[model samples]
Target chain A: MKHLYPIKESKQCELRKASPETIRFLLDYSKSLKIVSSRGLTFESNLN
Target chain B: MELHVDDASLVKNYLNGDEKALECLIARHNQRIFNFIYSKVFDTEITEDLFQETFIKVIRTLKLGKYNEEGKFLPWVMRIAHNLVMDHYRKNNRMPRYEGSEQFHVFAILEDDGVNAEKRLIRDQIESDLGVLVDRLPGEQREVVRMRMYQNMSFKEIAERTGVSINTALGRMRYALINLRKFIEENQIVLTD
Candidate 1:
């Protein structure tokens, strides 16, 4: 049987180590979105 | 500086109109969430993909105003990551043994009570998001897409309504989808389930 969940004793994730590319993608995608309220008004995400 | 801002406050700020708060919240919790996901997947690439999916779900929930946020932001995010991890396992046919009810009860909560409601919520959000994307197209193309997609109109009906030929309406929808795909690609957005 294969080990489904492997444990690496030597590895640890550091703080805020998320890839910049992913963050940039998320931010860009977020900015493109606008939340629409029940009244039909669009709210820009206002990332700036 | 948001150095001392709490999760609830950040969440509230983001909901109210400050998108930077979301960026701050993600940065603040990135390491912990990243580690939690990395521990489960043990592959940086897979962890990154799941991490993006987790936050994509988070952003959708927030955009839909579905997040209750009773000061449990981190745990809520952890739970989302956990579900995505389980989904990954199930997808890959590598599901591990469940620890116990203590650890697995979330599956019950999510599947039993939330799946349908959450799916509906996501569907609505995607509809609205697609509306925004459609609005970016030229006027003729936008009308064709709206008629076909939102109104569920046939090409013949759309042509009659728009006073264009059926082939023209069909051509417009083709261009609309092409433009929408281009925009989605340029933005790197995942529009489908």
Candidate 2:
């Protein structure tokens, strides 16, 4: 749905554009997050 | 097959313990979300924090088993980022302002072809932000803006390529700038260094 827009301009409610470094850091940080399940199981995912 | 996985499936997989699913999801939407946050805060450090926090909230909601938006993942994440940006401004007690200390013309940077290396970095950053805004214009206006800014096309060339008179192309450009100004002012987006 976001890809449907022709201009790169972000819509009022839409998010747009990211730097490579930001994305890399976010992915790494996301990997460190402990995703806890409803059953109390905690898991870590490796992004590398 | 990884490229073909949609957002909803990815979210489902992430909730089911497939961490790679969230990776795929983040990769898919990171640019827009990052840009969205960057546009509001104007500072990379703040944008980085907000981006991370936005995803943190996302993970918390998903982990709680309360996820519901099936096809609206990007917008949902965008809403989170937007709220975080607003919260940041609220905490600082300052409305987000245009980045530069002086009056800066967005179109001038868009048209600048002789930028030095240092200026090139700033210009590129501005162009990227403007590129996102350019994508939001109506069809004809967007086409004119893209041709003039990206293709380096003259008004005559734009008229020929777009099959319209020079005046019509010029009118579209004018209107596009008006709309862009309105968006910038209304959103208080930081498009400059």
Isolated chain A TM-score, each model = 0.41, 0.37
**Residue runs of model 2 more than 4 Å from their true location after superposition:** A1-48, B94-193
TM-score of 2: 0.45
Ten-residue stretch with the least lDDT total in model 1 chain A: A7-16
Error of 2 at B66 (Å): 2.1
TM-scores computed on chain B for all candidates:
0.48, 0.49
DockQ of 1: 0.35
How do the residues B1-193 of candidate 2 rate in per-residue lDDT, one tens digit apiece?
A: 8979889889988877888898788887777788888888777788878988898788877876667999889989999888898898897876644444457755546665676788889888888888888889999999999899888999999999999999999999999999999989988988776
Worst 10 residues of 1 chain B by lDDT: B95-104
> Residue by residue across B1-193, what tens digits does model 1's lDDT show?
7969989999998888788998998899888999899888887888999999999889878877889966999999999999999999998887554434655664675445545877888888888888889999999999998888878999999999999999999999999999999999998877775
Ten-residue region with minimum lDDT total, candidate 2 chain B? B94-103
Query: Per-residue lDDT for A47 in model 2?
Result: 41
Docking class of 2: acceptable
